[model samples]
Each structure stands twice: as structure tokens, then as C-alpha cells.
Target: MTNRKIVSPSDMAFSYMGRIDFSKPDSPLFIYAGSMVSTKFTGTSVGMMIFPHLIYKVTWIGVIVDGIQYKFDLNHSDTPVYIPIIDGLDEGEHTVTIYKRTAGSHHYFNFCGLMIDENAEVRPENHEYDMNIEVYGDSVSSGEVVEAVNYCEHTDPAHISQFDNSWFAYSLQLARKLNARINCNAQGGISLINGAGYFDNYIGMETVYKQMGYEPHFELTEWDFSRYTPDYVIIALGQNDANPDPKRIYEKEYREKWKSVYKNMVLDLNEKYGGKARFIVITTVLMHEPTWDDALDEIVNELAMDNVKRFKFRRNGAATPGHPRIPEQTEMADELFGFITGWES
Candidate 1:
């Protein structure tokens, strides 16, 4: 047993996946698939400071230590809570990783810091990936309900926090296969137009792309495009926009809107990021609609952006209502890996 010590986010080998605000050292805001914390420590017990937001309602976190995963829930709250990670270990050296498993619509949280044993030597891992990729999508990208037994088994909130696993999402899985580091800027039910049906408000990807944090109350910070450059940018959107609801589907207008929004997004990304990345626009496998696929193809062609391309996944069975399970996600990742590598070749 050693004395306890406190470590700041800056001290850890922190890798932020999506949009995040690190302006404040004490309370760095993690939004969407915003941040992932990884560090090596020599201690018996580890704890973290989690500040919850009341607006978004829920925060689900996935903690991985020595390859085992544990889920933690930090629901709506005003004050900060200190939760213990694990205690009573051999206490030599251990690697721990913490990541956001919830969707982007959920409220953001401030990862205050970490407390560990005093005598333990904490160091950041030297893990590095061969390539850097950024994926933008909805529930699929967020791995929402990926762990459910079936499409109907885990539909409730309890099942959601228990089953959603971002680490196993197609994007991350593909990243692992290609030895690439990825940032998943995704939210569940988000679309190019009005957002998903579950939420009350309409929050499109275009509107929330630049937000510092998902919640409205969090101070907005202009994301620095140059912060981290990626070799590939994958855009997986439109399922929500093409919702099965008759009221949601406006064939003519939807097609035009999709084209316009997609074109603008591509152009904006190229301009801001200096056209260095290859953008891949994708359609949802869950709702294999030809019309939607055609719209995406047109966007790529009309823009004539040589760097932009398109790819669609083969429809695999869903795990939850509309999201792919781990097995299906694995298939998607395999497809993506081949596509990306083939493109590179």
C-alpha cells in the first residue's frame, strides 16, 4: 500500500477522439466521442473526477484495464462525483483506458482529473498508430446498442448504458486492424437535416460539428482544424434524414438538401483542412435505399472533388432497433479496411 496522488489530464497520455475543449486544465470538456484517456500506473486503486451535466440526461463511460472492460454511469447531476476505478491489485504496473461510449446527443462531462497511489509511478503510454482517420456519422459510428442480444432485447436506458460499446464500433475496429488512430465524431439519430426522432429538438450534424461540447450550456470554442490532421475522413450520415416516417421523407427536397449540405460539408472540410485528406461518403447499411445512395454519389460527382469518394456497406442484421451489433460491426470494419487499403494501394 502506497500513499495516494492526484494526476491531471495533462499528465496522462490523453487522446481525444472527437471535438473537445481542453482550454481549462482543471475541467476539460469531453463531447461526443470526444476523449479517451490511457495511462500506465503502479498503484492499487484509481479514481476519477466526473462532472455531469443536467441537460443531456446521461453519460456512459467504458473503462478498460488489462483488456477487461467495465461500464460506469454518470447520470444528470450538478456536482462532481469521484468514482473509484479498481483497488486491491498486485500493484506493479497496469494500463488503463477510459472512453465515452454514449451517443453525441448526451450531455458532456468534465474529466476533472485522476487520483492514484502516491508511490505509484504514472506514465503515459507510447502507443502510436500508423495512420490517422476521422469518422463522422450517427448511432452506428457511436456503437449505440451494439451489445444488445437482438434488435429488441435491449431498448431501455439500463440496457443502453450496459450494451453500447464505442471501442467495438466499426470505425474503431477498422482503426485497430489498420494500426490507425481514429476520431469518431458521431451522434445517434443525427442527420444532415433535422436530427433523430427520439430527441425533441432538431440538431443536425452541420449545426453541432463545431460545438466545443454537445450541451448548449457549455461555452463554445472554435475547433482548431489544424489540431490533428487525418489521412482519411469517413462521413456516414443520412439515415435519420431519410426516416421511414412519411412526414420525414421529402423525396425531392431531401435529395436536393442532402446534395447541398454534403457538398458544403466537403468543401468546408477541404478548405479548413487544406484538402489533404481523402473524404469517403457512406450510406447506412440498415436502410439500404438506392435513392439515398444516389444522392451521395451525386454529391461526390457534382463537387468533382478528386479527393472525395463513396462507399456503402452490405446490409447486415441489426443488434438493436436500428444499429449493428458487434458481429455486424466487425463485418463492416473488415469491409472498410479493404476499401481503405485498396484505395491507398
Candidate 2:
């Protein structure tokens, strides 16, 4: 089936479900990578930090994996987008096709790109281990809002490309400081399971942990991670699932289910890597709800056993409107870096 045109938020949420197969060598899937920022239109609402409409241009890009043309959400005025991959196609050749269109009014930022290895391995042979790092999580992990895209209204077009060779993004910035290559697979607004949480919500730690082994449904070639291993795997999920909606409140049973999901996800990772890899879990900084934060703290405490460690992050003052901004991202990276290099002394 031809890919449907996605216009609404709900449609964007489940758009990954519709795709063609591109795993065969002859067939390649297309995906929308990178991001375009939008300037504040006269009547539009102010965008979120990760999706600020003032400093960035309105851009659209994509790539194909396995035969499916996976698209990114460019009209991210409300929340972030999560592009799903197949069950196990991480060991092959893949190509990405981008449709970059930027307006003259705003500077832009690219959403985190899809990262992969030859076959799901962490570090590849002869590949620099210290030079490679894999980041997994939601928008915050991908460097959501670096500037206001709409500030350039009615101005000359900004000289911005999605891959403008910059690392203002906290994840990429952190990678750069370490002199490591970044495999940033963090999507915006992703949940623990495929479709288990609300949009713009905190995705649980378990969900991201399970993402490392996922295969794209339409891969043009095989890609595997077995050949590549990162010295560190940073996980910055769990803000999107903290909402107190009537249907998703954390009751006793719900809490148990959440704990189970978190436990199993970590266990699976340990089993896959045989406890050789280090896992870091981070709490939400933009999260304002007390109940939600408390519950997450408890869950993090539970997941803190064995080889997994928990990193407590406070809300950064640089939140634009409501969500965390670039300042928060920088702070978060600083926190993680301290944990990494013993710089606290």
C-alpha cells in the first residue's frame, strides 16, 4: 500500500504501522530524518522546547529501511515523533532519503537520527570503542530545542541544513566531548511499547531498553549490532508516561505492571550482553507533576539493582514554556558526564 499522508497528531502517532517491506537487497525503505524548525506564525501557539517554532526552519526528511518508507513528523508543533523499526534487521546495508525544505524565517534543528550497527552488536571489530556511543530514548535524549525557530519571521532564509555539522544537541555534544561517534536512536515521544503511552509523554526506561534489539520492518539491507559495541549506553526516557490521565493512573496493579515491565526490559538487556555492557537510567527533568515524579523515583529505585544504575536529574530552569530546553539538555549531559569521568571531585 502507498504510504498515507499524515496530517494530524493521532495519525502521526501510529504512522509507523503502515509501511512496505524493504529488507531485500533490491528494495530499500525510505525514512524522514533530520528536522526543520518553524517560526512563530501570526496566529499559531508557541511551540514546545523540543519543537520550538521560532529559531528553526520547517523541514521534512526521511529514509527507507527494509522496503518501508518510514517518515518523521515535521509538523511537530505539539509533541515529538517516534519511528519504529522491524524485529531484527540490524545486520545489513541501509540507505536514507531526505526531503529537506526550510523556510527563510527560522533556524532549525534535526531530530535524533536512526542509529544502527551491522547486527545489533555494540562495538565492531577495529571500530573504535571509545569513539562509538549509542544513545536511546525520547526527545530529551535527542536535543529537542536549541533555539526558537520563529524568531526569524519574514527574514531572509537561514543558512541551516538538518545535518549542519553541529552538536548543540546535548547528546551529540556529549559524544563530541568524549570524541565518540554517536548512534543516536532517540525518537521524540516514544513509549515503552509500540503504542502504550500518550503523545509528548514520558516513555518508561523499559521501553528504551527493549529498543536496542528491534529490527526494522522494511530494511534495504541487513545491519547488526553484534559487530559494534559502545563503551556506554545512555538511556533518557520516562517523561512521556508520567501523565495522570484517568485511564493511566498508577494504581497498585498498574504500578506492579510498570515494575514488571521495567524489570523484564533490564533483564533482557543483561541477558543479551552477558553483563558486559553498562546501563544508565535517567529520571525526567521537565516533569512537574509530583505524583508522577515520585512514582518514577520509586521505579528507578527498583530498577537500580545489579548492573543497572539510576541517575536522578532535576528539572532545568531553561524549560521553554513547559518542556526542558537546550540548557536543561546541557545540564543533563553534565550530570551524566560527571558520572562517567568522576569529575565531581
TM for every model, in the order presented, reads 0.89, 0.53
Tens digits of per-residue lDDT for model 1 on 1-345?
Answer: 146777777764554455667788677777766257778888788878788664544557778887888878787667878878888878688888777777655657778777788877777678877888888888788887778645532343445355777888888888889998777888777777645434336667776665555444555456777777889999987767755363434467856766787788888988877889999988655644466676787888898877998887765222334567787788889998999999999
For model 1, state the Cα shift of residue 208 in Å.
Answer: 1.9
Candidate 2 lDDT over 63-164, as tens digits, reads: 343335443445445444444333344434433322222211222222332223222211112324254556666555544443434421122134333422
Lowest-sum lDDT 10-residue window in model 1: 152-161
Top of the candidates by lDDT: 1
Whole-model alpha-carbon lDDT for candidate 1: 0.73
What stretches of model 2 exceed 4 Å from their correct place?
1-131, 149-166, 193-195, 199-223, 243-249, 303-306, 314-321, 343-345
Instruction: Estimate the overall C-alpha local distance difference test score of candidate 2.
Output: 0.42
